[model samples]
Target: MDFGEFVMARTPALLRFAYLLTGDSHLAEDLIQEALVRVHRRWSSIEYQGGPEPYVRKAILNQYLSWRRRRSSAELVLAELPERRDPALGAEQIVERDEMWSLLATLPRAQRAVVVLRYYEDLADQDIALLLDCSPATVRVHAFKALKRLRAALTPTAVAGASHGRA
Candidate 1:
């Protein structure tokens, strides 16, 4: 397939992953857009890399980091807003998701990125290790710590949600 086709096919997944990483839908969109532009510019080079997705993902992460660095301390709190809510879900479900995201946000950047990439993106630990340019053992450590923090934040009902396959 061509570059446009590849990008079109991957955009939704990239957006979801970006949203999970940055938490704000609009900012995620902006991040993805900028990253995609850069990817498109280097498409010939990236197309031979086996998995351009990781390159794009790393670009998005770097974009977020740059954004954070440029932001004032006062803006940091707001810039890290939770993912946008779905109007379809019930209030309780919405609140639960928000709480979960909030807890995820509390993690150190590397840990949070690993958790989202592993659990939400369903990537193998080795893939995440490659994406983050870390060892598989380090990815495991980050995932472990992130899960611990999430588990600590969960209420009984939220824990039950996981058992019910709702989380």
Candidate 2:
């Protein structure tokens, strides 16, 4: 596919991937825009490398990591009001998802990226490592550490209760 067609097909998934990485819609949009600009400049080289999606994804990941490093000292602000919920879903589910996002946000950028790429993107260790320019072992370590932090933040009892409630 051509560059425009590739972008049209992949933008939604890319945006979702960015959102999962940054946990902020605005940041995700900015990240994608920055990445796409870089990708556009090197579209021919990227296309020659094979499919552009992987290249674009790697660009997005790099952009996010760089942005995080630059903004390390900045404070993150959340909206005062919660987002509107779907009436069909239970309040418990919304709370659980929000709590999960909050916990994810507390993780270091590398750990958070690994977790999101592995779990949300269903990427394997080698793929994640390639994306982050790290060893597979490093990816595993990040995932383990991130999961440990998440577990400590949200107890098993709470997870079980949430699951049970859903059932």
Using lDDT as the measure, the top candidate is 2
Go through the candidates in order and give the C-alpha RMSD of each one to the true structure.
8.4, 8.3
State the TM-score for model 2. Answer: 0.80
Estimate, for each residue in 1-167, the C-alpha lDDT of model 2 and write its tens digit: 77777777778788888899998877776787778877888787654455778889999999998884333333323322223458888889989999999999999999999999999999999999999999999999999999988996779787777778894
State TM-scores per candidate. 0.72, 0.80
lDDT of 1 at 46: 63
Measured by TM-score, the strongest candidate is 2
lDDT of each: 0.74, 0.83
Model 2, residue 165: C-alpha shift (Å): 33
Model 2 weakest 10-residue run by lDDT: 73-82
* Candidate 1 C-alpha lDDT tens digits along 76-158: 11323344557899999978888888888789888888888888889899988887778999999998988877785676677
lDDT of 1: 0.74
